[model samples]
Target: MLYLSSFTFPNDDMEFDFFMKIKRTCYDSFYPFKVLSRHGFERIDFEPVTILYGGNGSGKSTALNVIAERTKINRDSIYNKSNFYSDYVDMCEMHLKVDIPENSRIITSDDVFDYMLNIRNLNEGIDQKREKLFEEYLDAKYSSFQMNSIADYELLKKVNATKSKTQSRFVRNQLMGNVREYSNGESAFRYFTENIGENGLYILDEPENSLSPMRQMELMKFIEDSARFFGCQFIISTHSPFLLAMRGAKLYDLDENPVEVKRWTELKNVRTYYEFFKRYEDEF
Candidate 1:
């Protein structure tokens, strides 16, 4: 299930040596170069389900994107890479247990948000079309003009059809149904289900953004099932305790200086949640 067994990033010394060779000061940053090396995150030994846990600006995302780039996985959203981005990726290495599936992809929050936005936009367009169809139905149903010749056959059919059907039914016949209306959370979850197929590697970046606690738990179960029952592998960056607690998931705490692997319950974020909920146990 582990397509990618391990990956190595350029260390501080490598970044320093690379930067020392660069004489140009026009670029403001060497981004991915210094990002992971800052926390001494030199490598990742992946599992069937591996999670990178960290707060904002903790380089978890950087690591995922780097692996995605190095492994040539599919990505929907365009990530901004600095001038040194290629050089940084070149310095990194990936050890694959097997050839990465062609369907393997990196799913970012932007990808999910964009998918939801597209659905909303499509529904808006369909709604506008439905309004126009309503006006057309009324016009055709009440039109007094007689059919002059064969040229008016299509119009005649429309008039007869509109008159025979109710407004809602006529509009339904004229236009496709609204993209099966779903809330933002539902849309985000759907995006995941639609993209993730069997026996492929999927890198998900902060998938809990639009999901409720209930939905996060649902996703946790879904991911667990995919990894266990299906021949799938996952590399996720997240802070959600629900996702972090997935069965057999190896968690690397990016918050740690040396980026140590630890149990999900031991993560600072999970501990904070536990303490907060424990304090309110009596109220529940």
Candidate 2:
């Protein structure tokens, strides 16, 4: 789980050089020329697991997307570096030894929602097709029993009447079976657990999106187990202390000009959670 060396990107257009190493680490941003790095932070190398922490619009998601896109990791979102007033864009030359695992994949809330919607739509379409098939069978089989003038119509009705209600029932059951039963957060965590596998690099963007604190902790444990027992490597962007505090997780504060790593307890988001939890400690 350790990367033996480091690399530098000589030609990146973000007004700085990109310095990184491969050592079970994560870097928020390593634009080495910047003076005002977040929390006096600089590029960080991580342990097998890493977390990126920052506030809204602090570039946490942006950094995650960059890593995912740069590493050719499967992602739910497109990465872009648009310049003002033109279709031309800036691209980064990334350096690292990380290779994406065949079994590993990125999961986003957007991807999950779209997947569920597609399943729903597919089931609906199947229902429609089944109805049409039943009507057609009725028309073809019962045509001879009706009066000549309306024989075709009557036959279709008769055919439909003969169809086993069991067919419809089976189709309906299939449509409803195995459908997502959990809340969005629960579903997301479940999906994360299901998707991650051994010896793979997974880049997750804001995995905490739909998870409750308890679910987030569950996700944290899942990630820990995957990394420890399965040889899985993770690069995650999130503000969840539950995840950020994962044993030995490296953190990069993206709010700085140049991203850098600090202890989970030192992160602003973690501190906020700490203060809030402490305030309610007496009541509990």
Candidate 3:
């Protein structure tokens, strides 16, 4: 279950030494270096499920991207890479327990958004084709076939087929079915359920973004089952308490200096949710 046993980023001292040696203004900026150098976030050890918990700009996503790039895993959307991206990754180090499977991948929020967008576009195209099919059906059903040419042969076949069926049925047969069965949440969840294979490492970025509370819980169970039943490993960067609270998940508090590991209930976000709900407990 553990594909990546441990990985380490260069300490600030090392990065600072490298930074001082290089031309300060040569690249203008080394973004992740500045952010990730706040503390010596040394080694990150993985379990069946390793989670990076943080607020926005906490360097969790950056860390995931670095690991994904280092291992050359399959990824859906491109991540933000600066001129110094490789320089930063080079400074970091990783140790894998076993070979990273080719099916191992990183899934970002952009990938999920694009997946949803593509579905919408496909349905729009199908709708347009449906309108064209309506006209084609009418034409074929009422065509006065004067069979004198080869092109007419195709038309005659169409006319015969169209006349045999009702207009709606003919149009339905001609056009593709709309891809609207899944809602945004359902489709987003499907992206993970379908793309992720057994016995592979998966990295999810903000997977709870479009999911409701119930769907988030469903994803949590799915991830847990994937790791427990199948030989799958997951390293996720997320802000949702629902995902953060996954049972047996090893969580690193990226918001903390040096990135300390903590229990999910101890996270500020989970505490915030707890307090809010407790305040209105009687109403619930």
Best model number under lDDT: 1
Clashes of 1: 0
Could you give candidate 2's per-residue lDDT for residues 220-247 as a string of tens digits? 9988888888887777888787898899
- What's the lDDT for candidate 1? 0.93
> Per-prediction TM-score, please?
0.93, 0.70, 0.91
**In order, what lDDT does every prediction score?**
0.93, 0.61, 0.87
Candidate 3 lDDT score at position 55: 89
lDDT of 1 by residue, 1-284 (tens): 88999999999998889889988899878787778988899999999999999989999899999999999999999999999999999999999899999999999999998998888899999999998998999899998969999999999999999878999998887689888868899889989999999999999999999999999999999999999989899999999999999999999999999899999999999999999999999999
Q: What is the lDDT of residue 281 in candidate 1?
A: 100
Kindly report which residue stretches of model 2 are placed more than 4 angstroms away from their true locations once superposed.
2-42, 79-99, 123-180, 256-258
Worst 10 residues of 1 by lDDT: 172-181
Better of 1 and 3 by lDDT: 1
Question: Model 3 off-target regions past 4 Å?
Answer: 24-26, 143-153
For model 3, give the 10-residue run with minimal summed lDDT: 23-32
